[model samples]
Target: MPATVTKTWKLFIGGAFPRTESGRTIKAVAGGTVHHLCKASRKDLRDAVESARAAQVKWAASTAYLRGQVLHRLAEMMQARHGEFVDAIRATARITPRKARDEVDAAIEHVVCFAGWTDKIAIVLGSQNPVAGPFYTFSGIEPTGVVAVLAPDASPLLGALALACPALAAGNAVVLVASERHPIPALVLAEAFATSDLPGGVCNVLTGDHGELAPAMAGHRDIDAIVAAASGKRATALKEGVAENMKRVQVVDPDSDFTDARWRSPAVFRGVTECKTVWMPAMA
Candidate 1:
């Protein structure tokens, strides 16, 4: 038997692994094998978005409890594949086995944490109040619809899944741009999602050229929000670029601890609808 892995998996899109429409491949070392590039194009992005949109209405309307269950199922799937996730991370990101497993575990934990938030949002963030008038008014949260995420290169699995968990938990469909450094985890996560009973486009992952596709995302009217984990000039550029769609941006501290207590709160989450009300009356 061979000691080194000779083959790796393909990009998951529309519930399948497809060759690039461009019929092109980039040569890269994945799992100790010469891996072929799985090129994704603008059309693929649209297709993925369409699937996500189709799933949106039902997913958005789904009770927070059901959404949470779906996420917990996803976490279970991920936990079952924990070793494989670690192996893929170790191979692609070039991290120690312990480090790889930690990140993978952190991702799972993030999903489960967010899952708990689904039903608890009302208790934590919503409120019932006297309208100060004859009628009564109440406040609640809502999903922001489709959100596109640009996964950070440093901690591929963590950042991608971190943003994904909240993005989806809040009932928003998500599209993640896989990190250039480690695309394998995104694929594996995509596979886990495939088994999670999520809507087809509810969580889409693509591995491709960021520069080329980012502009399209920045200006996309369909996308309600966008998040990117980056440094230096790239961060600045993305902030300005997303202006066309007015997508919300959430910048994270790169050096922060993964298991920080602050992450448990809903205020820390981004990419959701927050309704503010104002009441004014003039008395004679």
Candidate 2:
């Protein structure tokens, strides 16, 4: 071997990979192999939020059926690149190939499941309400604009997918912060997404320290909500950061079994969605 070149992973923002504006790099070591990943700063977080905000409206405007198709296409892309995901998870997570394969399989399954829900969510989340007067009232679900997802340190691929798929299913733009310790899998998934039908900026991945970015995500004025897997003091800090704007915060157990049946529930989308009640003339 003449020379060894290490690749510095870039942040996925607005459907493109860009080096962090802060120009900081963090190293992740796995089995004597070192990987360089972008260290996203507060400024990077702001930029991700801006991209998400810009994409949210158009994404939300797409027909539910189209959104469902796009999501399913993402699943197909993941399946196509299944081996890459398995290897990434295995290397960073230090798991057996079989276990890594399982995680990748689960992640693909999770994406397909959420793809089905994109169209069905309205049926589960919306309702026709009884009105007192000669008016028809309906409650419909709407995307919560831009959402920030903080992936759990463990099960990097599955954990990130579990949080992100729901928000995407509900037609919200996402700003995903991959696991600090093992972010390669998330970035790998980002590559699959890049080739999929997902609109640019619809799902952005930032690789960096959650401790540094979570508070920034919580306090960001443009981010409408946060879905994170954290506990104890880490969880508390995230919650406290939302005091100013009161952004919707949903903190799940970091050790949550992502394979749990509850992940499929329409209720899972509630945190990242809003209910809009419309009243119209009965004749119309």
Candidate 3:
């Protein structure tokens, strides 16, 4: 008897299944066999950005509390699907089941922790400044609009979504380019987001032609920020590419304490970026 295909997941764009306009497909392998096809195309990216732009205004206007609520719901979803996520990790990252489950747990906890910071980060990272005169001056942390993330290829399942949540909780629309060779987990993430009330393109995940698409994302004008992890000569290339648009780039130091749970603590670095202020009494 032949196997029955009950369902096939499609690219999530504009909250609908608009297959790749270019009709491109990439294969994913497991246990030395190809078992899945992921879609990709230039038009798919365009449609994703369009979906993100459409919801950007309302999403940005929504209060931090509301955004946090959605994030909390996402955490709940992750916990329920823990096994599915671990399977993805074990296959892609080639980790033992025990280690894979640990990574999955870390990913989920990272989301739950980051979500809680949504309402309190600004208060903690934000501050009031002292001016020369009665003119009041203050700075509150704000989202950088649309963010694009190129997840670390080495730690696909855990590292990918780990970065995605922080960007979303900060009120930015994110388009993640998943690992090229390993994509099952990325697709699973897409399914999670689709049902999580993330409002479509807010968290679009595309897998294919990453070497070509990632550099383009850094240069695209619509991408306001990027958080990528890289090392070796490839890391150098990523820096050079992102320079094209001067996107707010953050290069994760490979040898740094990021792997340490302390550095991973939400209150430590999730939304703690700094900003400089200049005042000359309004140029007199």
- RMSD per model, one decimal: 3.6, 1.6, 3.6
Poorest 10 consecutive residues of model 3 by lDDT?
267-276
lDDT of 2 at 132: 86
Could you give the candidate ranking by TM-score, starting with the highest? 2, 1, 3
TM-score of each: 0.87, 0.96, 0.85
CA lDDT of every candidate: 0.74, 0.90, 0.68
Please list the residue runs of candidate 1 whose C-alpha ends up more than 4 Å from where it truly belongs after superposition.
1-8, 253-256, 276-284
Model 3 misplacement above 4 A:
1-9, 232-234, 241-243, 253-259, 262-284
Highest lDDT scorer = 2
Residue pairs in clash, model 3 = none
Per-residue CA lDDT of model 1 for 111-198, tens digit only, reads 8888898887766777666776655556677777887787877777887876667778888888787876677778888889889877
- Which pairs of residues collide in model 2? none
User: Compared with the true structure, what per-residue lDDT tens digits does model 2 show for residues 1-284?
Assistant: 68977556899999999999999999878668877889999999999889889999999999989999999999999999899888788767768899889988999999999989988888988999998898999999999989999999789999999999999999999999998888999999889889999999999999998888987887787888999998888788888857858789999998899888898888799899999999999986
TM-score preference between candidates 2 and 3, better one: 2
Error of 2 at 67 (Å): 0.9
